[model samples]
Target: MPEPKEIGHQIKFPNTLMGLFKKGWWEIPEIMASSCLGLLGIGLGFIAVLNYVKNDGDNREYKKVYMIMRPDDPRVPRLKNPVYTQYKG
Candidate 1:
């Protein structure tokens, strides 16, 4: 049995038009495809964080408004005797 390194080295490639250059991570087309996908994920993560922060600030503002409002705002109706009614024809 050949040594692992020797076995790995035994794989030969012809010096063709496509095989002239050495293979590296950046040399592979799949790396570029994955890089684009990673960039999109990073962009989406940034947008999500920005939205979360914006919504957190909005929540703080709404809480402050709620604290300052009067008990009897016409827009805020009180629920009295909450019950479910069934209609029969």
Candidate 2:
């Protein structure tokens, strides 16, 4: 290994690259590839989080079941509403 003073007063490369070289993160292309991939992942995660929060998250309006029928269809009998019975156990 060469002494720090032997190199020069200023580093030839960026600190990030130098630190990466020290950590051997550039052993293969995967780390470099992941750097780009990580940015993509961060973008996707941001979009997802934005969408969830945009609609007010868990407190957002939720649609319930509704009967779907056209005016052209034959008239149907009114369905009996199920009575809510209290459990007496």
Cα lDDT, model 1, residue 57: 33
**Tens-digit lDDT track of model 2 for 35-65:** 8799999999999999998755544123376
The TM-scores, one per candidate, come to: 0.35, 0.34
Write the residue-wise lDDT of candidate 1 on 11-83 in tens digits: 4445674453334232577875787799999999999999988655343322333333344665224333223
Query: Which stretches of candidate 2 lie above 4 Å from their native place?
Result: 1-28, 60-89
RMSD vs true structure, all candidates:
13.1, 12.6
C-alpha lDDT of all candidate models, in order: 0.55, 0.59
Model 2 residue 24 distance off true place after TM-score fit, in angstroms: 13
